[model samples]
Target: MNFSYSFPALRGIQAGREFYTVMCPLRLIPKIFLFDEEEIPAEHRAQRVMNRSRIPDITNYILENPKDYIFSSLTASVDGEMIFQEHSEELKDIGYLTISLDSKFLINDGQHRRAAIEEALKVFPELGEETISVVFFHDLGLVRSQQMFSDLNRHAVNTTSSIGILYDHRDQLSLITKALISDIPLLNRYTDREKVNLSKNSPKLFALNHIFNTNCRLLGKRKGEIISEQEKEFANQFWVLLCNTITEWQEVLNKKTSPRDLRVNSIVAHGVFLEAIGIIGYYLYFYHPDEWEKYVKKLKHIDWQRDNKEDWQGRAYSHTGRINKNNETVQLTANLIKKKIGLPLTEHEQKIEDKLKEASPLGT
Candidate 1:
């Protein structure tokens, strides 16, 4: 097989394992990759069967946004040893990698991304120059190649939600979440910036993920919705007023209560309640604009004490002892606040409330 292809590559080593990094143009990727599912013996194929369903969303993501997206480095097994040719003394650090595949190339990672890239090309073929990083491993036949696949995934841990929020610039909600944490001192001062869950002794008040989701709800936003400047300002003013009005939030900020104590003692410190407040805030701001501040006062009356299990049990927590964080709980919490403030539920909310009248929703 005349399988020659060449590209400039950077040489790197990890724990004495050698790998070559190459920037392959988008149009060339599909041509170079050969999914193992099609030709190889079942025992020899290191990759899972390609899930065609996942490709379209990723393909649309590339086509729709066109820019500001990420695809992690694709890991593939070369069909044969690739040769590195030194080009110049001045560029000793980089060299051209040339490969001739004697057999079908195998992907140990990023198979879905590879499939999506190919699909995306059908519509956005002009993105031919766009590049994705790839790391090549020398072929090790069937058994060793399978082992490599196992090893690659075994060490891969999903990125934490907070870290994703902190690093993502593409998602509009991530940007708003960052702004909220920066603009609201209370959230910034007490938030666990790296994790989604707070440990018992952690001084941080909430997860960055939690706040992002809560604020999105408050803005009446579905995920990925872009907010107008008016909505942004509304968010800024509403959250500041919320912190000022929620008694436990004020006590935590004032040092009258420690973050750990607040976390342990009150439902208010949980992200679930924050999201519930977001639902209420959206209703008040969207429908009762004139009475939002007045409604904020009603939040202070909630008996947030953790010992007040009677207060949240059937309303926010399930019988098996779990905080219900779904839409049902959100409506329930909104209804609770609506009752306290003497406001009526919207027709949609009243319906949800009626169905959930007897129990709290559960399951993570």
Candidate 2:
């Protein structure tokens, strides 16, 4: 006289332990699987506490792209017995898994996805018909469940920013970056598309993420903003003009100098300077749009050596000579670039420059 829930599942054995993979309806997710409430302490739970802040972004993703969204299988541990009934001897592992209604179902991983699913179902109940896979393992105890959680996440590493930008088709900036890399021969030849930090011996001059970020600044586009065709053309023209104007960039392009040596000796070869250039480009685009080329060509006259302490030390690098990539340093570098191009700084830029002068009266 016991009630039970049954699911079509595929049985499998892993490290001498039996497990089952089952397709679960989204509607059943909220009713059957259980997660520890926020009140539970670390020692008593198998998984980390649900990150409430992350739920909305994920739920919005599901809601925004219902037809194309994908979610990985959820891993859970059942704290009670499961009965697997096979079709026949020929297909012993393929059948139905039945569990009593009284058993406890605990989520060991992917608690966020489960929470998002519940929220999405509330908004669009038709999505409840969709199925998400769940891998169930027998819960040995708190220790075993904790070990499973640890093992599951120990090898998980997030993708590098460059690779993320390279693969992302949804972000307009990512798409424009990829297009820039393709259209500009200098970038196509020397841009590192998959790594964030280039090694000492790496042949590439700039990271893909750096290009994306600098372009975002140059166009003054916020994240997820729609980019116009004219803006895309302007970005292409600006970068191409920049590559031709910068003496060292042209040197590296023509194989007259090595990227390693340029990176070692020049601040202009770094991402900070790339971003500084973008900041300057923003001002030029707005204030001197018709004659920005005349100002940009003046870049060839400026000293970009890392050892040029009077110009670069406090702006592009710390007093200790280490390159700094903070916003303040980027702004400081852009202020110097604006002066070199004979462009006037905005009130905000002038204030930042004034503070630096007050802090270092001797212009150290």
In candidate 1, what are the lDDT values of residues 13-120, reduced to their tens digit?
866766789999989889888877556667767887888899888887888788767788999888675787776888764898888755457788999999899888
Please report the TM-score between candidate 1 and the true structure. 0.84
Listed in order, each prediction's TM-score against the native is 0.84, 0.94
- State in Å the error of residue 301, model 2: 1.7
What is the C-alpha lDDT profile of model 2 across 130-239, one tens digit per residue?
A: 99999999989989999999999999999998988888888788899999899888899999999988887899999998898899889999657899987888788899
Q: In candidate 1, which residue ranges exceed 4 Å CA deviation?
A: 1-3, 9-20, 38-44, 51-57, 60-70, 80-96, 320-322, 357-364
Residue 265 lDDT (model 2): 94
| Highest TM-score model number | 2
